[model samples]
Target: MNWNQFGYICRVKSSKTLSTEQKLQLCSESHLQIYKDNGSHSELAHNIAWQIAEDEETSQKQTACYKNIPDLINEFKFEHKGWLIYLTAVFIIYCFTSQLYQSFVVPQFVEMYSSFSPSLSATFDYYLTYWYVPIMLLALLLIIIVMAIIKLKNASSLTTTTPFSGMYNILLPRRLRNEYDALIAIIEFPYAYKKGFKATTAETIHFEKCESLGLELNDEFTVLLKQKLMSFNAMAKSYINKLVILYGIVIVVSVYLFVKMAYQPIFMMGEVL
Candidate 1:
């Protein structure tokens, strides 16, 4: 079922002198079928059961790393949830305010201002007429385009085999970089250890160097990386909270200015009368 259960079964079955099919049968059926179809002995389930079975300590380390994969993924999702919520709120409020300005505020003010200050009314009308909607729509479209481009580029760089691609990874946010390194270390540690490297030595290796050497995963390294990720998430939340407060202030100020501007023609008309 879950990774922990799957790992436990693998560890338990692997300890005995069971055939590969027998070990597969002992685990969850869904996982068993998937692994069978993939036909890859390098998969974690098979790797744990066959490769490091006799090495109890290494087996335990690999199993533990596999088990934490789900948790690390969950933590990453939770970190982004706050940002998505705030971004959605900003989008909704912008849409609602823009609708009110277009359908009610602009028309009503234009009518009222036309009776006295035609010149001022025409100036406001010209500025807010045809260009207003397109500008708003274009701004939104540009944001979406930029975000999509960045995502595509990041994905492409990550999949490339070039050793120099590590340079591109360095530009990612600290939290993202830490998360990527942690996951890579977790997945690749067993193979690296099997190749005669010590866990302690592997722990000290930089992620890029580890990656370039094709020996990029470890338990202690992931633990330290997780700590860094947690710290960054906390710091990121604090900054986002401050930004939300600042956004509220900006919205309030904008609304105040809109109200003042809407009535300024009336005040000028009264002065003339």
Candidate 2:
């Protein structure tokens, strides 16, 4: 079953009504169990189940977070659906137009121009030959830059295994920084803590800071985390919108330039004829 169904079951089967072994058995027999062997459950579900069986307060916190997972995921998908559709449409259009021009339009135009003007035909041939060179080079450059950035990030001393640490280290706005911090603190760190894993230096520091500030890791904290998550999703959608617009502009401008180049020769040939 999906997380929503599992969460609903958990909610219905209150801890006060069920013993710790019952909760553990529920987790093991559920779809969350990845292996038939003893104690081999999906990490998140296992951690949540263990937390619930261990402490009443932590159980309440985890139960609240567990029930909200579906809403959180749905909200993210809803926020970015429009931009995703735009991106898919643009990609399809670009691919279809490029294929159609190369397969049908190019040959016809080359034949027509060749019969009328050899120079124009040569110009068309040259453009057709090299049109993709710059695009390929730019793509290569972007790949190289991304690889370099990843390498640098890996080599940096500040690097941690925190979920959003890479993004957190980037030059994000103060608001996004807070959201990333909250994500790590409320979600990831707690899971790691419950799973008996050693906290990384960054996680330890964040937890200390939260404690120093007298932050309670309660239902209110979960609500704050949910808000931060939604805010981050909104920011992600904004970035995606900007990227889609920028990419659409690039595609339009490239097509325009190609059309102008292709037609300019035809116009010159017409004038000569």
Highest TM-score, which number?
2
Model 2 score (lDDT): 0.52
**Candidate 2 off by > 4 Å:** 5-42, 51-67, 78-93, 115-118, 132-181, 188-218, 266-273
Instruction: State the lDDT of candidate 2 residue by residue for 73-155, as single tens digits.
Output: 44444233354455556566666777788789888878777786245666566668776754554344334333433332221
Which one wins on lDDT? 2
Worst 10 residues of 1 by lDDT: 155-164
Model 1, TM vs. native: 0.53
Query: After superposition on all CA atoms, what RMSD does each candidate show versus the true structure?
Result: 7.9, 8.0
